[model samples]
Target chain A: MLSKPNVEVSNKSMLGRLFRKNNKNIIGIFTVVLALLFISPYIYIVLTSIKPSSDAISSSPTFFPRQLSLENYVTMFNQMPIIRYFLNSFTTASISTILAVFLGALAAYGLSRFSSKTGHAFLLLTLCVRMIPMISIAIPMYIIINVMGLIDTRIALIITYTAINVPFSIWLMIGFFNNIPKEFDEAARIDGCNVFSAFIKVILPVSLPGLATAAIFCFMLAWNDFLFALLLTSTNAKTATVGISEFLTAYNLDLGPMTAAAVSFSLPIMVFSILVQRYIVSGMTLGAVKE
Target chain B: MTKESRVSIYFFAPAGIFMLIFLFFPVALLIRDSFFEIDMIGQGRGAFVGLSHYVDAIRSERFIGATTNTIIYVVVAVGFELILGLFFALLLNTAFKGHGIVRTIMLAPLMIAPLVSGLIWRFMLNNQFGIVNKLLYDFNITSSRHAIQWLSDERFSLFSTIIADIWLTTPFMMLVLLAGLQGISPTLYESSQIDGANKIQTFLYVTLPSLFPVMIVAVLIRTVDAARTFDIVWVLTQGGPSNSSEVLSTYMYKTLTRYGQVGESSAMAVMFILLLLAISSYFLFVMFKANKK
Candidate 1:
């Protein structure tokens, strides 16, 4: 026997109270605050990049730039072969990613489809390599690469990175390929497709998300690499990481150009992560825990 | 049977050979090199000074410092990253608006290369013109009017390295834990709630038990990574302020590449690898046991 006006008012108040009590609201605020903290250094870098060196070095730092300047960016380009370094990083990372992914997928397909002790062994080897620290390989790799006369070359970087990433790519792809119902592959085979053809036609299309994740990981590994890039490549084939290292010299450090260089170097990985975040997270953590 | 076997071998041969050559072969060479007394300048000119390099490395004060620092680095960094990562994961797991974007942004540091992260932090931790100091001063948090010498001081350099490491790696831990959290069924929480359980009790009984396996794996990975940390420390401190920040890898690199003592470095590298292997194997065993249970 409630009046319509009274019923409507009560409903409105209940909804309002629900909103006030919702835990999501509290969580949302907390997450935003933490996210801002996570990105604070990068934000500071961007702000510092535009400010004059004197302002940057001042005891009391300004939060915002009073005057914006492109001097750091300009100086970074002029002082070093920034473009050449970028090209080196790009070409090496791209080629390595392509090679690693293709070969990894091929190997993963074979491993997942075939049931054999050897396949298991291959999988074990992949995991072993993934776990071993890179220093274990650095000196011998140096010796071997030197012997091959491939010092200070993009090919050397590409080959090393590709070799290093293939194991991970294969391991990741195996899980993805495994998750797909084997019935699809079986049905394709029954329809007169060979294993290779079925993998190409059916499996590849279905595992695009997995492939993308692996490709991004491979690219990031090659791109962000420093130790191999530092030891193997001199100025002739130095990547962005090596280029950033050159910002610090024996006599003096250029803070402005260094910040600008660091920002530019990190931009690609940042964009890629933002673009393909969903796959990267799921793919990286796919086989980490068993159901 | 023969034909199928042959095809399988053909499929695996490329990957297998690559690992044996590039991965196993290098480790073998490291072992071989560790036994020799090779100077840094020469390519391979050395005598077979069996165990001499190992003896020297064990006795070296720098090696001892590196070992101590490496242990401290791994324990502190991994411990803190795990705790912080778990906290953030729990925060993000709540049904929140814009949670997805926040999660992605939190993962930004993980995606960036360690060297680049080191450089980024180096800029931020700079005594002059660094924003950390700026913020501290702006908020009147620290009365020390000068920019903190983060890398220059040995006492604070390890902590500085830890900060950068924790920043770079906590996302990895969070991602793993988040995935683990997702695997958990909501029905359990609902049942607990029906029993008049509070948030903390439900989380302790349900969430913590389910997350144990993934947490172990995540911690293991982070521990191994933290123990072998080189690039960030290398870029930031380079084991400076009188070798106070030197971890094992940096110590090895300095001996071989910088100080021209290849044999000693190789021995140090071998020891470092063995230590890591032992730790990782133990973790793997724990994981297997957990899975069996």
Candidate 2:
């Protein structure tokens, strides 16, 4: 009886030891599988983009293409003014990002230095404005832009995106500015720098990371926007998002160029986003989670 | 005013005026237009129609159906995200090899544009040439490649969009929850273990309660975002197959742009804003009460 009880105890301990030893390996496998699952769809898109037109739409499509060619990409460029769409997306996103960050950073500095009822109330108002659905103001914005005769122009896209991005920029920069000591600007002030000049010199230099984060977010917003682009721009100012979507209807179920266009349109943003993933994760929740 | 106060006003003026002209002014126009019959082509405002547009929206089956679909989308999409997000967060909380790479890979979806995501999904969900059904058939889960029609069928169109959204946003949820999990104190878990709590018990009592505040914030942000979703649904099905997948944003777009019913769309937009405000205010109230404790 004594030996039997001792044997059972040893068996249990052996099983526990084995579990503890293999647990890490099991977890490693799981993490790899999950990562592959996350990325496989993207890889598939890339592969499909490279496949010849006939292979892409084949009834029995395989994961690995039988033939690899850039024919679809060539077709995509020929079919539409693809380069123009890219340029429109790029210029609008870049210009709006710069403008929004500049205006927003200034407001953030003002609010941080002098916290009054009006400033605080303005902060709240911006927050509420951020919550307003984009569709709510679409018609009015369309009419107003039409009245200004800026329709079908990249300038219209730039103006609208800048306005849409400013509130978010202000909100994000305010958090960063609040962390900055009042003494930085005060020291600059003692050296005969005025409020605006002090901000230009002392504050803006230290807030580069904050500005970069806000810019990246604004750029993403403008780049990813489909609704406003669809409404505001017609031909000359059509963005990549709208242009790629047009392939859905314009080509009548043409998978080859469609996939190729989708890949080219999305790849740069994906690479850019991944490289700056750290800044993005923090900006996503608006600094709700402190690092 | 003091000199510093005066300086601050100069700082505020540029952004303030810009927002007034572009943001606030447009919203004010939206409200005003909702009350009048507006002509886009002729650039004319017809006679005031009181609350008739609002009444028309309330009575319209399309508007009501869109509202129902929006609510359904928000609930199911966010619901699955929370569960899957927590699962991934817990799985990654432990130290392992390639942890950083795996986490980065998980974030790739968040980086992809929603319009692109929608397009990719539409391609994959195609019955004849799609890899998704192909894989399922290879694995013997389905009898044929055309066993399920993803975008073409009315029953699965909305669900198809939901899947794409789930794929795109789940990483965000995971990142937020992972951060929350990291913030939790180790001592709480140690104490729970010492008190004879199993893994399940410890997760339920120590982990969940501690993660509640972060969860609420993440959920609220996602709720508002998912409610405004336009790109994915628009790209995937355009709310088609007899309008089975029509959500508020798409419906309003069609009403205004497709049908050119400016007054009706504006009224619907106003109603949509009010509903979102109510939902967010309730969430804020709850968060406020939670914080007071």
Candidate 3:
């Protein structure tokens, strides 16, 4: 934009052209500054995580760390059950994604293919579930999990995560399935396949991109959850999110290891998201495609 | 039952059962628990106290403060995010080269756990050694010997949390609005130009109306999420500086987890749900109304 053709020297239009050129330059500069504002904290955290101990806590702040080292990360690994937390988070997140996607696909198929007024109402009511804050349901959930003797278990977290994410998954699937021709379902029926087999052998295969998108989203939502993990789990099932939170309350000493822990906690999911962000656009924009 | 209805029933069974068991049953229990004084340990029932817990929470200073703080936080944060998101969406819609990299960087915060960003914000808001303070001093916004209490002082703690939240969620608003922006046809702009419309008029008459649904969707999502804000408040101040920054989520959490007030916390939860439900219903109505139009 800044490389646009230069203004020709003409008396009548010189000022207007100059003003337009300057406005473009202003927008270009503003865009870069805004990007830096958004990106700087992550960079700062990463740098602080790896900075040598001497410079990490130095009274004078430095933009870039002088001596890069892995000391803080080493300490975080040794001192905390970071690996266990990661394992728990990963296991629960994956299980929840699979469960949510499967169950949501089923419900969405029922709603989309059946197309009853009752099904429409059910879908609308489920949309309301997205508005129900997790914290509101948490008090009873805590007691309910305890009542069932499922407290401090990854399955508890997985069940809760799946339950919460299912509504979203269902909505996304409805959007995806709506686009698929109903004639395909008819074609399968004409071939003598039942509804279940028709979905499995026909619709399911073609909706891979949509499934991948929804699955990735469910995984992300479950992985990033902290409130559920906090309220639901005890020591055995604590997630990486709660593990990092404890470093604040329990290990409140040096910021180095905490930052290191924070970085490492977020690194895998961050990289995962960056790789799959293209899918996020399709997965989440169902709001734009809705009735 | 007919074959199709049976198939529908079979397909819906897993999710329907799961929600009824986990989500709805728990909600029923929450409503019941609010009327009883329950044991902290076993959660055994005590005495039936009808509407007393609700009354007390309604009258409580802490709850009132938390409600006030939540309103301020949600209003300021979501309002700012909308304006800034629309601004950036407009910028992104320029189709400039390398904007893809910028878009990825802008959205990096959304991918990571919001809890981590809350922690990072806490680190950045440290008065003594934080970059925020350092930058302030660099620009002579403060003295080397003095720093603003970004999270420590009562005046700035909630504001600090809002800034962190803005950092975390604005990308989401931007992406949603950008999707909305991109959905508008270029022919609309050409028609507006053909009619001698300027930038301001084109934006007011053409862009805003077209983006309304997306804007409504973005607002609905952000507002509900903002109302339930926990991670940032917990990490930053724990609703601290003497409860000045306490949001409903942190208040409800601390009430149950710290004070062990199950009955009252359940009441608080009830109130929180109703409030959100009422507000969200209004938004949902608007959404469906817009869709009809």
Candidate 4:
């Protein structure tokens, strides 16, 4: 009986030791492998963008180019209205994001502070609108924009993106607003400030991070939008996303300019994402934890 | 009304009106249009067709194929995304250096416009002189002579789309799951470890249960989004190679805009909306119930 117990204890210890050793190796190796997989495609795109046209089209693509050049980037700027598209995208997305964030903040504050049952209903309704597929709204929006003579206008894009983003932005902002203690509002109210003034002066400053989160997401959504941009805009107000698609149609099978345009079109969004990485992640996972 | 009530109304009115006009009104108009046949060429001079359009839409083989393809695409793409996303999330959740940079880089694909992603993938997946084919050939995994038709072939086009979709969206899943993972208290893992629980046991008992709620939310969101994927697939294949890769959204676009079959297209649109509503509501119901629990 003594020998049997001793043997069992030794066996368990051996297994535990082996498991720990293997687990460390496995986790470390897996993390590195995953990191590589995730980064490779992006690296490939950047490398290819800088590669000469001849090398890009070569049968065996070079992982590391012998001669790197900004020829493609230069060609992209010269061959297409790249600057014009960037301006259009920037203006539309920025204006829409500003409007959406403002509207969303106001609505969220209202809902959180007053009218409990009705506010819940209204919030639910907003979420429902957000759930509706963009394609479902595509045709009617097309007709409505045409009828209103707003097609191909930046105003049209701004209004449309705002309408779509408000629901989500409000939803996210409500969570943030709810987290702000009621005492802060009461203190502001007691300080001879009305609700609106309190909101502007006190609440807004405190919730800047949340607001930034909402604004960044709203901007990215509007910036990266393709479908509405395609439908609403023509040459005059065409956003970068739509402009890139137009490039595909214009260039057809010409890989050089197409790839260059693709690289140029994706650059701003990449930079924007990296810039707002913290806000975006926080905004995205805002409601994942109730506390 | 109370002072608070009045203030609430004033604050909410603008956004409410905006949503009503642009979102609710358009949706109402879409529902109405589906009931009528409006000819684009003839300046909206078409008769009310009632349920005829819906009937035609349901009967059309193209619509049926689109429905199947969409279901398949959503199931496959979302399945892979969830599994792969969970795996990556678990990997990233560990205490590792440079994890933040990796997370941001993983999100790089998600940041790009879907159209741009499609274009990039199109270049990479091109049968002739494409990077993917060249890589395979160089590694002797496949011959240059046997270069796979990534986009043109029906069997492969959908898979290629899935690859692009996974690349763009798995990060979203990872982000959500990472949030979920963070919510799991380290105490639970510590207790499990003290009790002599193995890694898989700890994951099964502790990690999964804690992650379930977030997983449901993540999966539902991804499913709804995937079902409505239009821009990526539209740019990549345009429902090409005999309409083998066409989903409902692309099919509707082609039917209405390309072919000018407004009635049929509207019918398809209505059906698509109904299907989307059903799926979303189902997900919402599940989420609501889970939250209640």
Leading candidate by TM-score: 2
Shares of reference contacts reproduced by the candidates, in order, are 0.62, 0.70, 0.68, 0.65
Interface RMSD, in order shown: 1.8, 1.2, 1.6, 1.9
The superposed Cα distance between candidate 3 and the true structure at residue A164, in angstroms, equals 0.7
Candidate 1 chain B TM?
0.94
In DockQ, how does model 2 score against the reference complex? Answer: 0.67
Model 4 residue B293 CA deviation in Å: 5.1
Model 3 C-alpha lDDT per residue in residues A214-277, reported as the tens digit of each score: 8998998888899989998979999989898877753245677889989887877678788888
lDDT (Cα, tens digit) per residue for candidate 4, span A103-153:
989998988887457556756766566567787788788878888999899
Listed in order, each prediction's TM-score against the native is 0.92, 0.95, 0.93, 0.92
lDDT of 2 by residue, A1-291 (tens): 355668888999999988975897799788889779877888898999999988888878888778999999999999999999999999999999999999999887887777846546756776577668888867779888999999999989998999998888887888889889999988999999987899999999999999999999999999889999999999999999999998886333578899999999888888888999988988885534545
User: Which should have the higher TM-score, number 2 or number 3?
Assistant: 2
Residue B221 miss distance in model 2 (angstroms): 1.1
Mark the 10 consecutive residues where model 2 chain A has the least summed lDDT.
A116-125
lDDT score at residue A195, model 2, on the 0-100 scale = 79
Candidate 4 residue-wise lDDT, B65-174, digit = tens: 88999999999999999999998888888756667767777777767777877887877887766788877887898876347888888899988987888888888898
List candidate 2 segments past 4 Å from native.
A1-21, A116-123, A250-252
